[model samples]
Target: MTAAQFRTVQQPLDPTAAVGEIALFDAGGNPLDLSGGGQKITSVKATALAAGTAPTATLANGVLTIGIPAGAKGAPGTAGVGVKSISLTKDTDGNITGGTVTKTDNSTTAITVTTA
Candidate 1:
């Protein structure tokens, strides 16, 4: 008696489901990690300063003055020609209340200050 042989069959590919939430890619087109506990993202509003076209202020005579709108309170005034160390005093609210400026070098230095 001769035994019957069974033929092997190939399965058909299913193409019904669609992909959800496409993965993010970097500038080099590489997949980025989107898992939890990854890098923290902080967003700042789009301001004039953030744009690259903003005009920068000029530094004159070793002084860098920032351009703030009028009626705005300016920063604390600084004294002394050469300041090296700064002393700070904190208030009850944990804010800096006072500060003292000291000269960078000793007064006995050979460098003389000539007043014009």
Candidate 2:
């Protein structure tokens, strides 16, 4: 096509109320993405954990609070190599009564705990 067959003009587009949809196009007449803040949004995925009692979930003022399971109480990790013996004394009912934990380090720190 010759130059005369093409025309370039700038026209203001101000649609009034009750008008139809508004479509945006690029230089090549291809439909441009103007969905999410004038940018392209491919997918959106949100996951929410299941609800519970002791460990409940709360959301307030765009903030989320999730409760995690509490750690084991009155228990130490595996005794290190320098530990001589990690003894735990219990009664006949299997209830933990008391214990004496000893570690064979240079300082030899000994700890004793009694619940009964």
TM-score for each model? 0.21, 0.21
Candidate 2, residue 16: how far the Cα is off, in Å: 46
Q: Candidate 1, residues 6-102: lDDT per residue as tens digits?
A: 1113445445753223233444545544356554223212213333332223223333223322343468997656756766766698766666656
* Clash counts for the predictions, in order: 0, 0
- Model 2 superposed RMSD (Cα): 22.0
Model 1: ten consecutive residues of lowest lDDT: 1-10
lDDT of 2 at 114: 57
TM-score of 1: 0.21
Off by over 4 Å in 1: 1-81, 105-116
